[model samples]
Target: MASESPEMNRLHPFSAVTTTLNRGIVGLSVPFFLIGVLSSVTDAVDPVWSIYLAPIGLVAGVAYGLTYYYRFEYALTQDTFDLSSGVFSRRSREIPFRRIQNVDVRQGLVQQLLGVAVVTIETAGGGDTEAQLNFVSEDEANRLQREIRRLTAAANGERSATEAETASSDEDEDEEATSNETADLETAATPERHSDPGVSEDERHEQPVDHGEPTRLFELSSRELGLYSFTSFSFAAVGGVLFLLLFANDAIFGLLISMAEPLGGPANLDSASPLEYGVFGIISLVNGLALTYLFSVVYTFLGYYGFQVGRAGEDLVYERGLLQRYSGSIPLEKVQSLTVSDNPLQRQIGYAGLWIETAGYGPDSGGGSQSAIPLARKRRVYGFAERLSGLERPSFRRPTTVARRRYLGRYSIIAGVVVAGAFGLSLVTAVENWWLAAVVFLAVPPAAHLRWVNLGYYVGEDNLVIRSGFWKRRTTVVPYYRLQTVSTRRSIFQRRLGLASLVVDTASSRTFFWATPTIYDLEYEVAREINETTRQRLQSALRERARSSDSEDGDAGVSVAFT
Candidate 1:
């Protein structure tokens, strides 16, 4: 029996409501406000006319939503996933199965309430998502993800088989006539396999592939979550508080004055004792820090609540979030490298995070990378990274001593600039004791030494590990097979100091920015040697991987023939 062909489908009907709210209301909000202001300023138009615009905009929004809903369509064809959508100008896209990298499903608060989800598809080499099916039924979103995965796997298998057969044929042609005769004899003796009569080609290809039961790898406990939140120390929270104070200074000052009335208010501050002044200042500083910490805790909890990670066959599956749920998979085969990262606070508390960097953009990821374990014990995080990359914690080799001098000079310049700026401002303003600002210079030496201590790299048998940064340290492990390029770099100062840096580039999008993995300020000769050795190792690893893949493909082909 022939399998039915897939038909074009539209988004869930509730999508129109979401579209109206997200697009229509947001689009008209500014114009509506402007019209209302115009009516109030000039009596050329009645305020009643401005009121009518609300219903008019709502109707326009609904009409636009219905039109958008009708125009958008998607279908899963035999070879490609097709989409067509337009409001003013028509646009269409066809994405081939083999090119698809990931299919992620996400549901924001509104979509969750409406029982709908957004399906985002990503492909290799793109900086953004390849396709998004906005507002589909939850079940339909899952079905699409499964279907796309199955088709992609089948397509890749067929392509690999074809290439293998071609390579085998070429090898056979290069052999002597005696070997060819033997091969012909073996081929003639082997029995030919026949397909089942009832199974169509489409049905055979569409047969479900078992991904196996998910093995839970990690889960964030409530206690650990709290600790993670507390230690994260988001600067965004502090910035938000500062911004609020900037915009609402009068109201905030009034409240502060009312609260300080018991302390004789701001009016009596001139006559206050030194002890009283110290206490008041301490209380204010503590209150500000506490408020910032509270904001950070709330934000972290909302983003990471109920975080869980599991392995399902060839992919690592993760689900996280409290209000807006997200579920995605990291394809093991596509992973470029693994990064173990921790800030100063996390390092002190013996906790760190594991990040997975892949070949293409990840849904809601930070530059082609996503957190595999947001927060875990240091030992556990290192263990997980080793399990994936087969490398233990490396003893990193520090850079040349001159690198430390370079850092000291760099930090001293920064401190000098800061102090100069403060002193200059004091000279202009009514501020006294401008010389006290030189205290910043005292921190420069320690800061430079700490930076030098944190910067190091280790060249392993099959992986390259580079650790760097003092405030937000990251230890990245890159397998030779995943290496794309290796080069040495030197600045004018580095050249003068006989120093160079080794940069290892990967397919990760993070490399597009200046965040490419680098071993900083090594001896020039050492950097050159390592760069050459790494390139050689990269070639060897590629060849080994190719042989391994061919062996597995041959085994799979044999099993299929026997079946």
Candidate 2:
């Protein structure tokens, strides 16, 4: 790709588009922001002709300045990488080749149309001292990826020429071994045997090969993405609706104050003109469901809209974005675990979520790197994740939920606390309502019962799969290594019942409200079994790897030990 001068380069590459876009988007929401400001000013002023120009200008200027600072320049140097930007701070990021972990090339819709892709290089250490680049042509993207890979390999003292000759002769033998072995990765045979360094981005271009699958750059059916309005966080559509509805300032205020209470249930109840109430109920129910569906549609569109996923070399790449396109890639070897989820609804419909838990992408990520792929069949999830996970048997296990009776008792206690608190407060304050407490009491029993029935776990060779959710059920799998920590807890009631809750914490932004409270008791024997087995397995694997390396060192006649 031809290099563009900074003066004319409008496309943001190696720049903070997220930060710039944040400013622009927020600045553009002036209409919404102004409404509140104008209303408050108008109420305070006698002459409404007076304006608040200073505040308006100040807000826009600050946002613009923020956006400007976010632009940057990044380049891959001969032996090191560097990134420079920041409006006032003018900070520069430079790192040696050894610090780089992985390189990614991503292309979103607009980028694809423009024949451009963003190349990202990530490292494991903390602090904002790493390099990040944003926009480059597809040619440059490939070139940059190879450059980083070459430098990183060289830094590790990789003997590429020797490794290549050895790998070429080993390939046939490895293929034969693959036939005999039950499992072996496709990549293991090739080992990325390449000898080119200092190759230009344009020179690195290679013709693409067919993968024999439906090479869908974009995957979505009209009914699935549009009609169902589904997303990774299913039923989270409600939160989006509530956010929009919060702009329903009138409604929010009505709720906040006791103003809506004396409206006497809006004449929609059965007792107040039964026919009218029935008609209203029909209308209200439809409206509520439609409103709920709206959330699904918006989430599906904004987050996963224009989603495109495909394989690039040995990596699985996914690109999705609406106003701003985002593309990311994951190396197969970096992946630590694979998770599959299916709700009753999803099972009936034949669609499941495929998730990859990668060590690079935080093995502790509970949901793993996800794909919006519609692998509906049970066999399909296994078939795909197995291939995606290099054909390893995923440790598939269902999460255990405490029995219905146990949950019921817990809910009963929660309900009693809420009810008693409300009942006592109502008498003393005359401000609190006892009816809300009654609804809580009625609701807890069935919700708890449903929760218990829905909870289950599946244990596979390498992953533990968890399935739960009442209405819009969700199943997620988390590997034992993905766990940051694990603990057990039990209430007095649970102690009496001879059950304890096992909680596994993964590093995720996903809330643990529904997740942590559940994770019912695994017997001491079962808990010990899992811990000991994994611990021993990990130890044996590490020792085996060490032994192999030692043999390699011995073959090279390298002496170390006490020397």
Stretches > 4 Å off in candidate 1: 1-5, 20-61, 166-209, 235-251, 258-286, 511-514, 553-563
Clashes of each: 0, 20
lDDT per residue (tens digit) for residues 276-316 in model 2: 55455565555556777766767566655666565443345
Worst 10 residues of 1 by lDDT: 191-200
Model 1 vs truth, CA RMSD: 10.3
How does model 2 fare in lDDT?
0.50
TM-score of 2: 0.60
Candidate 1 lands at a TM-score of: 0.79
What's the TM-score of each model vs. the native? 0.79, 0.60
lDDT of each: 0.73, 0.50
Tens digit of per-residue lDDT, candidate 1, span 245-300? 67866666556545555664443456766566665566556667888899888877
Clash pairs, model 1 backbone: none
